[model samples]
Target: MADKTLTSANSVLLIGVTGLYTVPQQLQGFSEDDMYSMEAVDTAELKMGADGVLSAGWIPQIKTMGVTLQADSDSNTFFEAWYAAQEAAQEILYGFGSVTQTSVGKSYPLLRGVLSSYTPFAEAKKTLQPRKFQIKWQTALGVPI
Candidate 1:
């Protein structure tokens, strides 16, 4: 008998893309940072209505993505990206997330999106801790994870 393909996996997504915010990730390339660690905890969700008599339909009005991008590089690449956008008063460069499951060897594609916030901070009075930036992305398509 043939073996069944396993479905279990790990690592929701890795966000390390850069370039024009309005452009898709296909145009731009994901950054190559050895120390950077990017992870997506929350994926696009259905814009459902409040609990009602009937079950909530799959009519997702808006889809969004939330990511946690962390890096220990002192070069300030993260800050520079946000600073450039802020200085020009334009939308910042977005990322194209690749949701992958190592166990199953499957990959899920996520649309590009802009960062919700542009502030990276470390806990005050902390001893040698890397700063984690919590950013949100606005995507129209739903994520398949």
Candidate 2:
């Protein structure tokens, strides 16, 4: 197959309510949403012999998913997903999916993650107009499906 540069063409984030691990129903992308970022685990250590010397084998770790958005006063998904997780009040299902541009779509699930962090504004600078927010989640066990 010829190489093709992939961009965020067909990216999606679906967050829903579920007590179990079932994939959530997809939702409409927020109006001000800008980007989705996934932080895949860098390495995992496994003891193995390489050239008769002990070496730590490496493997891809679960991805930490993130999405950045210009502040939207009306979208309550953030409050529902992040704050709820903080309080352990209820289970919220979230997933992020990406598709490579191809004749037939090549989709990758960056994270079927569980919401972990939400930082609305780390520093509310006067110069930083148009408030931005970040919401993050860690991959559930055996995630990135």
TM-score of 2: 0.51
Against the true structure, whose TM-score is highest?
2
* Residues 1-145, model 1: lDDT tens digits: 2433544323444455465333322211222332223344443343544654443334323234433333344434644565576568665565666555555555655555455544455444545344444444444334433
Off by over 4 Å in 2: 1-5, 20-34, 46-54, 58-60, 73-82, 85-104, 110-112, 120-145
Residue 145's lDDT within candidate 2 is 23
lDDT per residue (tens digit) for residues 1-145 in model 2: 4644454545555554344324444433433445555565667686667667766767756555555543443344543445555467555555443423243345454454555656544345664323333434444333222
In order, candidate lDDTs are: 0.44, 0.47
lDDT of 2 at 106: 52
TM agreement with the true structure for every prediction: 0.47, 0.51
By summed lDDT, the worst window of 10 consecutive residues in model 1 runs over 25-34
